[model samples]
Target: MNDINREFVSHDEALARAEAGVAKLAATRNDRWYPKFHIASNGGWINDPNGLCYYRGRWHVYYQLHPYSTQWGSCHWGHVSSDDMITWKREPIAFAPSLEADRDGVFSGSAVTGDDGRLWVFYTGHRWANGVDDADDNLEVQCAAVSDDGVHFEKLGVIIDNPKGFRHFRDPKVWKQDGMWYMVFGMSTADARGEVLLYSSENMRIWHFEQVLFRHPNPGVYMLECPDFFPVTDKDGNEKWVIGFSAMGSKPSGFMNRNANNAGYMIGTWEPGGQFTPETEFRLWDCGHNFYAPQSFNTVAGDTDDNTDGRQIMYGWYSPFVQPIPLDDEGWCGQLTLPREVFLGEDGDIHTVPAAEMAGLREDSTDLGVVEVKSGTETVVAENAEAMEIEMTIDLKNTTADRAGIKVHATPDGSYTYVAYDDQIGGIVLDRQANAFGDRGYRVAPLTADELAADQLTLRIYVDRGSVEVYVNDGHQTMSSYSYAADGPRAVKLVAESGDLTVASLTLHNLKSIGLE
Candidate 1:
């Protein structure tokens, strides 16, 4: 399957090849590190979610798939579809590296529904013609494929080549606006700074070069990989654009430092002439350790509503840059974050919460109603639930505790993942060193005074087999990280570290496995 000259003459030929690759996944189904509620590869490596969209009547999600092994190589588009974003059905491979143009790999891209109800995917076609050289040495081009029934795809061939003088260009994110389709590709200048190029297509075939969307002012060690642009409006109905990209090289200052590569977004306005005038600096988009290359999709189907108030849901790769996954030996290496709903505030601030569909996984319930804890005390709210969802409101206004919040995956041997709010520092601290598989550390995000009240610290936490995701105050802020807990009974605890703490309300729901089903 790794042979570059392998060719699939028809759709059936490609589907057969995909079936062979997925057949080996059953042996690793019982691995301890495999995620219970996330989308992961059947038997290979998956990274950088591609072509995420709602097509026909179901939600389709595509990811960078390396089918032959648990390591990176020539990639294809692995397909998964769901009625709701929570539970998914693994479809056959959507796009394979079978054509001569994309013989090496079919890289990251986005999906769009056409005017005539057809589905089109614009992806980066890559080939390893030369050995690893500078970014220009790799032959990268933007290619297109179309599907009539949202399953079988016909390669429409390369739509846009490397028009920029620099040779590094790929990852075409396409969206329709004002009767024309617009695309933005991730690229870098000759000096190696990250950049994005824009193009417009009157029809799906011919494309016209627009302009460079944005470039770094300083040419340090930086090359942007994935570029995503979409519009968001706050509660006040003021609209703005969110420009996002995955950055590599030296980490940008003020962003999260858990990983060297940071994925971020810029809040700004897209001018009439295609210039992005920023109102705020580039900010960390997801306050998590293993989140990157997030692609947002419009929920409406083709030629339907204008998508003015649709949900801004995004899915991201849940793996760090160079860290090896615990399940690599079992022949799979990556998983996707749970779908998150992004919210833009009136003042141009951004936050993300779990998608509403995740509620469907709740099965049984535990109610720890209105508990109170004194200083230096902790209480177990729920126990013996490996996969569960917990929600509570901490009265930060009435409490004088230096730190008070929830602890998850707590074991009898004094090991747990800690998520606490420190009023002394006015920030949330996510400490996972006790249970993390790799170089674990504490990650923090600021909690502003405006977000705190005597009885208003809303917290939502989702804990699965191997990961924990926290959403604060309906996504006013979020902290997501991965941890590998031991095999034993687990307890969820709420502690008041310094002073008195009051829980206005608390509820826990045992969640069924979204993948095992």
Candidate 2:
């Protein structure tokens, strides 16, 4: 017998193992750095938000999960459901590495409602040739699981075998458009060039290869993972399509692509089973250090309610791959970025804003009206900085500072993460080198001339226990990263580096916990 056969377990046994592991960790896990509102794993590790869809009046989100340890291992699908997208309830583990096709692991994929009124999930079944998890030499194929109630899934085995001449193939994002089912798979040619392969099916089971939807122009990018394609309407009522994926082996350029891996998207035009023609160059989805593998909710799938309202809502893995996560020793690591509504901008680009339902989390509100800071001074905006939501507008027309913005997770010992607009670089900078845990570096989000011409810069920031997500100018740009302070009594401060600046308006809101504990 082969090594995989020797190690394989029945579906029931696999699920029991996962549940026992989670139960053991729950009894003694630490909550020091657990997020107050974000979707984090109960224990162990999670990455790559998968199988996002609006089904039966609830938002269903599945993720790549490894429940036995706080590290990456053989994968299972972790499940959660929400009625309003703000408060979530954990569901049973969805998929596990049980069958021969998935003896090694279950990777990332998407979900769609089948014609038979069942929720169908399509994912990659991975097996390493050397019989070791995460080994470089492996085989991957597309697989499916179906559920009538969205809680229990029945494995359908392999759906699409590995295609020839592809060294890497995985991450199937499936959707329906114009009465046909279409799927996109991230693949790398045997020659090591990254491309997105398109396929179509009248029914969800049988798929036929169409053509290459899009390819990375840069040969340096060896592979693209977690590809998502969706349509959005712009402010002028012009419809456009967007292609997004996470790029591995992407070289760093200035302040972009600095993370170990980067996620980006291109605005383009694509028809059902047709070629995708790009209208804009590739752009980073979030100019931050820890955002990747974003998946959008399929609003048209299943029996979705009017709450979605045809919005392209998305969630990303809020942790960087191949980086140190400080909370691993505490028995859990990784989180999901807040749900963002993506739309096509008038400038022919994609922009994301926090979902409207997020306002429901606000509790006590304080309006710190019209605060000004001198050239060499700083003003404390809020003393209770932990678990807060802050919105502020800086009057750039009347500002003369070289650098002006807010400092979050600030400690009295001169340690804080700074988010500011730098006049010298003409970009927004997120600096976390001052006594923060994990990776420490700065990232810049460059502004276009049109953006700089505007007289004000609006910022909406969410500060959790160990992370901060900043939305700039209503999500024309965003930065999401983990920043943990070593000392307590952290405060939020507004500072001017070289010259005076005026704050036209500022408000702080104490957000309520989602009761994840």
Q: Against the hidden reference, what TM-scores do the models get?
A: 0.92, 0.96
List the global CA lDDT of all models.
Answer: 0.77, 0.85
The most accurate candidate by lDDT is 2
- lDDT tens per residue, model 1, 1-517: 1233235455467657866875676455545657778888777888999988887667889999887777777788888888666678888788877666576788999999987679998998787656443343677788888998767888777788766545568889998888888999888777788887889988978999889888855466357778988888868787789888887674545535457677888888894456987778767766777778889887863635443237877988876454645656766677888888887865458888788888888888778788898999998887765888888888766777999888888877777888888887777788877874554677777777677543578888888777788887777777777766766777888889879888889999888777632
lDDT of 1: 0.77
